[model samples]
Each structure stands twice: as structure tokens, then as C-alpha cells.
Target: MCTLLWQWFSEVELNSGELYLYHNSGTARRAINSNKIFGIGTPRYHFFNNLFWTESWWGNLCSDPPNWIGDYNVYVRRGESPLWDTQKNQAQAAGIDLHGRWAEGEISPYRDADEEDFRLMEKSPALDAGADAARLDGSPAGNTMACLFGIRLLRYGPGGSGRGPRRRDPGRLRARALRWPARE
Candidate 1:
């Protein structure tokens, strides 16, 4: 039985859709799954610059889709499992996650996941791991917009003092910049 974190059913149509610059962590099952008819599933699903971390053996990253385009992402697994390596290798061989890397560490890239602080650590490999925003086909990934928004919110929003440094990093949030302020 394959449990999925994000699943697309056969009824939904996703053409030229892009999924990028997101961060998915924790003990979920598969990160992405799709319903297939015959052997082909959805098409034109592009994934880029995302991070996936899992602590369980059931944490398969993606299902095999014929035209899925994925790259520049990071995959991290905590415990030892042959299934994890095998599935990852199969995904690569099947033309998924071509430029993606398997981050090897027991420690999470985030500062304190247990505390719900999804900030990237100073030495995190995911710091500069994202692809250029302009290179993506669609409107830039939400992460870029969120970073800009987060900055504005911090500088000009309600309690903001309107005076602070702004920096940018890869992944879901402006984690490195927001969490660890830049030093003079």
C-alpha cells in the first residue's frame, strides 16, 4: 500500500504545470503520487528546486510519470533503508531528479524542525541549491513571491519597524535571511 502526501487523481488535468522551490519534510509516505491509466500518468508536470526530507522508509519521493521533468531538488533520508536508495536511483534512471542530490545527514537542514522553525541552518546544503527564478517557464515559483512578501511584511507590516536587512535563500522561505539576520 502506497500512501501519498500529494496525490493527483486521474480526473485532474495538469498541463504545463510547474511545482518548484517547495520544502516537504517529516514522516510522510510518498511525496508525489499520481493515478495512472495503463502506464502513463499526468504529463507536463515539472518539479524543480524542491527539498524532501523523510524519516520513514515509506517516504518515496515521486512516482514514475512519462513526461515528468524534475531537477535541482534535494532528497534527505534519516535512517538506513535499501528501499530509499533503490527508489531514488530508479527515479534518477527514469529521468527524474537528474540534477538532484541525496543529502546525507542525520541532522535536518532546518534550524529546529521540532519547534516548527523551518529556517535553514547556516551550513545547510540547501542554502543555494535552488535554480534561477527566471529560468522557470511559468510565473516564478511561489517561494520567490513569498520571500518578497515576507520581506515586505517584516519591513513594513503591522509591527515591523521598517528597518532591517533583507537577504534571500533557496527553498520554501527566506529562511536563512529571516532566521539568521545578516551580519555587518
Candidate 2:
């Protein structure tokens, strides 16, 4: 789950382990067997860039809501509602992913996720959709910009243009929580 990329056509289940960069056509479910993290009232799960066709069901009915970090992602469902419908209010209340959106099929960020080409297309909603992590710090050192794994690195500055690939580890993910501005 470090810097690689993919798209899925099935459900992603996180029963009692960690998953990264995997795609699933079904709901991502987590069992409620009383893990230390869940028992203590906070779950430190991190989900990024992955797509889901259904709700990220957490621990059936008995388990408490999960505390996870999710951002810079898209969620869409056909017909009446999305996978997160049942947990919509709860999830939002807990701030699961205030940044995610109910994207339409045509607005999908990927050029063709069905064909496994996950690159963001022109006018993609996902362009710069991630949290502006580098801007959190107010000092000169904190003024740096970052382009995380898999996404095209675009640098804009005086007489400057640079691009590269970078992976985000837990150490790098511990910065202050910030929300992306709302889109029109």
C-alpha cells in the first residue's frame, strides 16, 4: 500500500487488518470483534484514493462508529442513494470524510476506471482534491508543497517546474487536520 495504484471490481473487506490502495466493487466492511483500537473508542485507519461502490460498513450494529482519516476521495452510487446513506449523518457527525463528494458517473476523476486507467482526466474533480497538507505549518520550513504518491506532481513557483513521485507514511500523515475548500 505504498505508492502503487489500482482499481477494483469487488468488495473491500477490512475484517481485522490493514489495507491500502486496493479497489473493490463492493462495500468495505470491518468486523466488530472488540479490537484494542475499537475498544478504546478511536480507530486510526487511513483511507486515501481508493474508490468504493458501497458504504464502509463498520462493525455491524454493536460496534461504535469508527474514527478514521479519509480525504481527497470520491463516492458515487446509482439509483436512489449512495453506500454511505445509512451512516450518512453519523459519518458526517464524526467527520469521517467531510471532503468526499457524491460524484456523478460522467464526472469520475479517472479517465477510465473500468479499463483500469486510473489517471485523473481533464477537468477531473480529483485534481488537487487532496488536503493541502504542506500549508498547515506557518513557518518558512512549513511552506513547502507536497505531491503524494501516484498523483502527478505539479510544482508552481518562480522559474520553477518539477515533478516526481512520493509516498506518504504514518510519520508524514501526522500533520494537523485541515479541510479542503468547498467547490462550486
Candidate 3:
């Protein structure tokens, strides 16, 4: 069983402003049991431009939070009907991932997940399928730096002004070059 985000509070804390933003991330599991992508937890969360792949019915277990918002994410489930995915449908019905998409036939969006090459394919739906991330925080989503597997990459905001190459591809890596730094 693999879980991504799990949060639990001993006491209820309403409107604590504990906002968590999960953007351009990927989570996958090979198990076929009832696995949870997100555990029941407090704190509002925003999910955007992510890829979730699982082989269980309980792909996402935390969708009851009123303040939790999600959009422009991809969901892939093994052996599930292409027309409908229960977890994605439930999230959409609850107004969480209104713009989320489901990958048919459990097709992986990554180039080679087995080898841990998470780069998106050339025709991947995740390419340019992301909404402007600024909408989540009402601030310009510029100058954001992400570290993937210890490789640091830069993401430019509006007008393509920042560091490194200008690529707006969605998902965590954003199709940037992977630099391996020497371990100390």
C-alpha cells in the first residue's frame, strides 16, 4: 500500500489556514488492494497539475474537505473502466477536481515509470493540460523552484521570465533537464 499525503489532528481545527498546495507532482502504486492516495486529514489542500496512478478503489480517500480544491490533474487506474473512474468521479461530483482527467486503460503519462523516468511523453495529455497555477493562491506563480529526486529545476512565471529554459509543460519536472549533483 502506498499513501501520499496523510494528515490527522487530535482535535478539530477549523479554518486554520493550513493550506497545502500539491502541484506538478506524480504518485503511483502497483498494489491492487484498497490503497489510499490521501488519508483522512485536516488542513485545506489544493491539488493541481498532478498525475495519480493506482490499482485500487480507494485511490483518493480525502475528498470531504470543503476548502480542498483540485483541478487540471490526471488519474490512471489499472483494470478500471475507461469511461469512468470512481475516485475521479467522486472528486468531480464533490467539486474538488472539476477539471481532472482520467487516463484511459491505465495508460501511464510518464515516459518510463518502471525506470523512474517521470518525463512526460511527446503526446502526453499532461502536456499543456494545466491551468495557470496562480489561481490557487491569487499570487503570480513565478520563480518557483522544484527539486525532483535531488535535481533542481526552475519554473518561469508569466511572460517566460525567470531562470533556466522556458517550458510550461505540466507535472513536477516540467520537461527540464536533469542535473545530477555530486553527493558530499
Candidate 4:
């Protein structure tokens, strides 16, 4: 079972769409059903975690995004209680030890998304202020969005055949039970 889960993890891709780890939000040992999210393409790992941010996402927003990417982004978020000159002021902090929130321990994909609603995306201005905000084309952003996503790594179950790492349903509260010591 552990081997299946491991194999699944090793094969997850980040180009399909919204990926999800089969099982509840707490189930650890599970599979990635690429057909669950949008159900268009084969249920494959398409999303990755966002590994770019200054402040910790766990503490700040407590979210897990697919594909940990580097985001040099800029977005327009409606500011509230404009105490500062800009609404994006306190909302855009960066560079935090997400390890404490996400990579700190084992977590089921379901629980992560359920708690946060899977709405974590990076923001960037797509354009500079002095770069002709009218028709000014925006610059490319590095992955600066602050989030930690858990992508569907593999798909192995009744739905797929040799499609992903073969893993049994680790069911709820099983994430902690999975004890596969790193192979020597």
C-alpha cells in the first residue's frame, strides 16, 4: 500500500487541471483521480504547489495550492478598510516558513481543500504603474503567489489500470497511520 502511494506520488503531473487526492481531507494513503475535479481529461495530476511567498500561508491563510511554483505576480484585490494608501497593503505580505503550516506534517488533500475552499491563487499587476497602465503590456511574473497546494500525484484504484501508483484507500484518519520508512 505504501509503495503504491509512493509510486503515485512520484508520477503526479501538474498540467492537467484541478487535481485532487482521493479519500477524505484527512486520508493520507490514497490515489489521485484525475477525473474528479473537472472530469474532462483523464484524472491526472495537473496542479502543483505554490512555493513562492514571504509570510507563511498556513498561519496567514492556511491554504494548500497545487504545484509549489515561484510566482513573481501582481493582482488587483479589492481592498477593504483602506487604512493605508492602498488596499493591497496588508494583504500582500511575502516570504514565510510554510513548512510550519503545510510541509510540517502529513495531510489529506480532501481536508486541506475542504478547510480552505481551494481558492488560493497568486496575484500580480500583469503591468507596471509607469509602464503605460492604459495599453501597457504586463511583465511576466515569477511564481510569487503565497500558497501550498497538494496536487494529485497518482491514480490507482477501481477507476484506473496501471495508470498511477497502486494505493489502497487510506480512509480518514489514516494519514497518520501510514508508516512507510524511506527505503534504504
Candidate 2 Cα RMSD after full superposition onto the native fold (Å): 13.7
Residues forming the 10-long window of minimal summed lDDT in candidate 1: 174-183
Number of clashes in every candidate structure?
Answer: 0, 4, 1, 46
Ordered list by TM-score, greatest first: 1, 3, 2, 4
Write the number of the candidate with greater lDDT, choosing between 2 and 3.
Answer: 3
RMSD for each model, in Å, please? 11.9, 13.7, 12.5, 19.1
Please name the candidate that would achieve the greatest TM-score relative to the true structure. Answer: 1
| Over 4 Å off, model 4 | 1-70, 81-124, 128-153, 158-184
Task: Give candidate 3's whole-model lDDT.
Answer: 0.46
Residue 76 of model 1 has an lDDT of: 70
- lDDT tens digits, residue span 38-82, model 2: 233324345544444333334432345565555445554433444
User: Highest lDDT among the candidates is held by which one?
Assistant: 1
Give the Å shift of residue 56 in candidate 1. 7.5
Question: Residue 14 CA error for candidate 1 (Å)?
Answer: 11
Model 3, runs deviating above 4 Å: 1-17, 29-40, 56-67, 81-84, 134-184
- Candidate 1 vs candidate 4: the TM-score winner is 1
Cα-lDDT of candidate 4: 0.25
